[model samples]
Target: MTYCVGMLLDKGMAFMSDTRTNSGVDNISTFRKMFSWSVPGERFITMMTAGNLATTQALISQLEERTKAPSERKPSILEAPTMFQVANIIGTTLRDTIAARALTGPVAASPAPNFNASVIVGGQIAGMEPRLYLIYPEGNFIEASPETPFFQIGETKYGRPILVRGFESHMSFADITKLLMVSFDSTLKANLSVGLPLDLMLYRNDDFAPFHERRITADDPYFEKISDSWSEALRNAFHSLPDYELDA
Candidate 1:
């Protein structure tokens, strides 16, 4: 269980993912759910994964290895000509990993554990348009549109509405971060499955380089400030909105 979100803005893209993985009451651990690769000024890609740790880790490992291999199997994420191709590689990797794991387990149990993982992939490849996509377990995906400028995966229900009410295609990168803090707060308050230290990415349009990548912890000053201010603002907004009168 986790919470990961990617937002597509006119200026660029913003992403955040939690690092907590819990197996039971006595077993809680930290494993980064975010992965990024870039060719400096040319292209950049970031992925946030949720579900079974083993499957996600294996997929990421293969992607990383492919990037480093002398004779890479195909168009790896690092070498993809477009962001769409990158998504396809990741989707295929995830699906293949799931399929391989099935060979070792009982027929029915194989899919159960692996099918839970999903990925939110977003960014820009040089000479291509920036985009946000959600990759399902079946090696398929859907992209975010102008009308829908965001995609979220994992323990998603709690933090979703904040973006729904406030997200806009034209919002600046900073405002998008504030909105993400509010959304993560909503999920943090409601779901123990998703916990902090969060990895956040901010990419400016056509820059193809990200200088604002952060791992926000429980003690981080900026996150603390934003969380407090947002809670107070929400309470005030709720009270200030005109109440509907009920007719007799």
Candidate 2:
């Protein structure tokens, strides 16, 4: 399992993803679940994956290869004229890969192996509005809108409340980071499979570019501070809330 989120704010987009891949209690491993591509002044795209590690890696590698040989392959997401087309390309690739693997043998047919995968793709194309999408295992997807404004995959339930409570479409980069920390904290507390070392990407709208990107490791000082501060804040909030002292 993993945890990833993409928010479509009035300013632009913010994305965060965890590194942990669930194998088993004893077989857990760390693998980056986020990737991004930029075409300088032309376009910027990012994908945060969850589910089967092998399947996700294969899909990404194929996309990278296509991107590298643009003339020999269909236009990669970064080269697509619109974010919608970019998403279509990714979804097709994911579905085709799954089909191809299943043809190989019974081993591929088994769900125990790494074949279930999905991705969250978010970014911008020059002339169009910025967008966010959650691509599912079947290659179908849904977009984020003003009403939703955000999308999550993998161990999503635990972290959802925090996002709902604090997210604002007009939040600044700093405030968004604080909201993300709370969401990450909730997931970390409830799910063992979603662990540290996150990938973060922030794109300010109309730039046609990704101006900020970061890899957040376990020992990152700012994250450490935020975690500590949030803990204290939560404890105080809990104490201050009126309690149910029924028999009185």
Highest lDDT scorer: 1
In order, candidate lDDTs are 0.87, 0.86
Question: Tens digit of lDDT per residue, candidate 2, span 1-248?
Answer: 89999999999999999999867799988898889888877788889998778789999999999988878657777677888898999999898887777666476454544477898999887777889999988888899999999999999999998898889999998899778878997888788999998888888987866677888888999988888898899999999999988995
Using all chains and alpha carbons, the TM-scores for the candidates as numbered come to 0.93, 0.93
Model 1 lDDT, full chain set: 0.87
In candidate 1, how many Å is residue 152 off?
0.3
Worst 10 residues of 2 by lDDT: 105-114
TM-score of 1: 0.93
Candidate 1, 78-193: lDDT as tens digits:
77877888889999999998888877757677335544579999889767889889999999999999977789888889888888998987987888888899899989988888
What lDDT is reached at residue 60 by model 2?
94
Off by over 4 Å in 2: 107-114
The RMSD of every model to the true structure, in order and in angstroms, is 1.9, 1.8
